[model samples]
Target chain A: MEVINIQGTDDTPNVILDKNNNKFEISGRSLPEDVNMFYEPIMDWIDGYAEAPNEKTEFNFKLEYFNTASSKIILDILLKFEEIVESGHDVKIKWHYHEEEEDMLEAGEEYADIVEIPFEYEAYTD
Target chain B: MENSHENHSFLDFAYQLYRTMKTNEISLVYEGEVTQDITKTFTSLTEKSLAKSEESNAVQRKVFNVMVECLQNISKHADALSEEEDERRGIVMVSKGDDCYNIITGNVIKNGKIPGLKENLEQVNSLDKKGLSDLYKKQMKEGRISDKGGAGLGLIDIAKKTGSELSYQFKKISDEVSFFILTSTIRRNN
Candidate 1:
């Protein structure tokens, strides 16, 4: 599959899904007005990638902020990874948040609790 | 002479409104059509203002999140007062109090939607933090997105982030339409 590299905008996030480079990260804000239209292709790409499967998939979520609608989409993305794990593959999520953003950290914890995959949290400072 | 007098009255009214906003410590007040571009502009403006005021990053993020939800709610769900009017028009205001910042939004909605919306807000308000968290997860997993692109989780998420009861009011404008006002508060010290 081809790599998906989308530059971040004021309301959207930067997404990079490259199997060759071993980089799968989504960072920045996500509050797109048309959530479905903005995320459909990314969801489709993941679905296609789940077929071939990497040896050990490590996904990173370095989101500064996301709205409620994007929260649902993020959950969906996590659940998709869980499906890959259920099919006898290794997948881990690296949840990155700012040290001052307890809310973002808690959001990561919530997502970790809801999903069956392992999540490793890392805090950063500006 | 008559036209000049009318112009003078209009200017006086505008000055009075500006004074009221300033006295109330209203940082931003927008009353017009709510669109995607407008949402971006409003959030960016608020973000800059919050940062300038020396608010903590966490509080700024919370305010930005709540404000986005409020503005998107208006853009997605606001109803026209008449059949011919198609634009989504609403009013959004951000005001600062001693301890908390308030995000208030108002828009016209169909009368038939009042009961369901009221019930939903009441249910969201009645839950504790754990209950709200559970509800939010459950809804995220099971609830389908509406035609308007809502995940049915905005209210719950707003309540969760604010950690306060959501206050609201509904005023009947006519037999077919009513104006709905919702206020969500975020404490500065939180």
Candidate 2:
């Protein structure tokens, strides 16, 4: 499958999906005015990627900030990965959050609890 | 050089509001369209101000997070009748009290939306932190998210962050609109 690469902006996250390299990641601050508009394409890409699923997929999320709207979309993205795992594709999620941010950590844990993906949390200090 | 009585009264009203805000110990305020650009500007400005206040990292995060939610609530949910430019105008402020920090936001909402909004706020206010967290997890699992990216999660998140009952008021501005003010508080000790 062809790689899907979208650059990040001040109000949106960067997304990279490559079935060839088995690489997938999203990182940045997400506070789009029209969240559905911003997320639709990524959702489409993920749905397409699921058709020809990669043998192993590791999705990294390094979001420094995101609004509640973006939060819902993030959960949807994680749930899509669950679909891949259900299809016998190996999938994992790495959630990177600031070490001091208990809020972000709990947010990661919340996603991990609802989804079946082997979610690992990596914390960093400033 | 003209000291009209109407102008004097207006100045008095402005001074009264200034005094009220000062008395509330407000550190930040923005009274205009709550656009994405404004959110970024206010968040960064508040970040700098919070740093100067020497607040703990956790407090700063809570304040900033809750502030962002309130601002988004205005941008997403607030309404305007017709195409008036000021219809999108909103009021957002951050005040430091002795016990907690208050993030207050106000915007015009259609009179029709008042009942449902009141119900939603009351439902969220009725829950405690644990209850709110459980509700958040349940909603997340159930995938009750809306197309606009909120399933009443923002209010729940604010309640969770504030650790207190959400406070709000509605002032009827016209037959078609009401000015809605919502305030969430984060305890200083937290």
Candidate 3:
């Protein structure tokens, strides 16, 4: 699969899905006005990867802020990863938050609670 | 002379509105078409302004998230007046009090829609934090996104992030429509 690299905008996140390196990372603020239009491509990419995922797939989310619409899409992304894990690949999700962002931390926990994936928390002092 | 006088009065009215907003602790207020570009610019400005005075990035983020949701709500659901269906007829305001930040948004709606709007809001207001969390998770799994790409969790997210009950009202503008006002508050200390 070819790598998908999307640059971050003020209202959307940067998405980097590197098939060769086996790294999938999404970061920055994502509150796109049209949530579906913004997330549809990423979902499509994941749909393709789920059929034949890497042996060890790692995903990282470092969102500073996301609206409710983006929140649902984030969950959809994680649920797709569950398929990758179900196919026998080891999957790990790293949820990052600033030291003072308790809400972000709690948000990660909420997703972890609902999904059947292990989530690691990394806090930045900034 | 008449045109110059009209311009001067318009300026005077704007200046008075600015003074009134400042007196009420409002840091930002925007009334115009709630387009995507406006939503982005408004949210960014609000984020930068909140970051300057608040210490916790968490609170700042929460505030920003709530503001985005409300502004987008305006853009998506605000009733267009007529033929052209312009995304106007909306107002968004932000005020910082000593203890909290208030994000208030108002948009016109067909009068008949008030009942459904009130019911959804009341249902949201009835839930506690845990209940809201559970409801949000349930709605997320439903996968029934609105035409505007909303997940039907706008009110729930606002309640969860702010740790405060939502307050709203409907001001009747005519027999067929009204302007809905929604106010969400985020605390300075958590």
Q: Which candidate number would show the highest lDDT if scored against the true structure?
A: 1
Tens digit of lDDT per residue, candidate 1, span B1-190?
9999999999999999999989889988889999989999999999998889888988999999999999999999999999999999999999999899999999999999999999999999999999898999889889877778899999999999999999999999999999999999999997
Candidate 2: where are CA atoms >4 Å away? B4-23, B81-86, B141-150
For model 3, residues B46-95, the per-residue Cα lDDT tens digits are 77776677457777888888988898888778896654676656998899
Worst 10-residue lDDT window, candidate 3 chain A: A29-38
Q: After superposition, how far is residue B111 of candidate 1 from its true place, in Å?
A: 0.9
The total number of steric clashes, by the backbone 3 Å criterion, in model 1 comes to: 0
For A30-72, candidate 3 gives per-residue lDDT tens digits of 9887788988989999999888888888899998888888988
Poorest 10 consecutive residues by lDDT, candidate 2 chain B:
B143-152
List the candidate 3 regions with Cα displacement exceeding 4 Å. Answer: B1-15, B82-85
Of 1 and 2, which scores higher on DockQ?
1
The deviation in Å at residue A8 for candidate 2 is: 2.8
Q: Lowest lDDT 10-mer window, candidate 1 chain B?
A: B140-149
Score chain A of each prediction against the true chain A by TM-score and list the results. 0.98, 0.94, 0.97
Better of 1 and 3 by lDDT: 1
Instruction: Evaluate all candidate structures by whole-model CA lDDT and list the values in order.
Output: 0.94, 0.84, 0.87
Flag regions of model 1 displaced more than 4 Å: none
lDDT of model 1, residue A91: 97
Q: Sort the predicted structures by TM-score, highest score first.
A: 1, 3, 2
| Candidate 2: residue B1 lDDT (0-100) | 36
* Candidate with best DockQ: 1
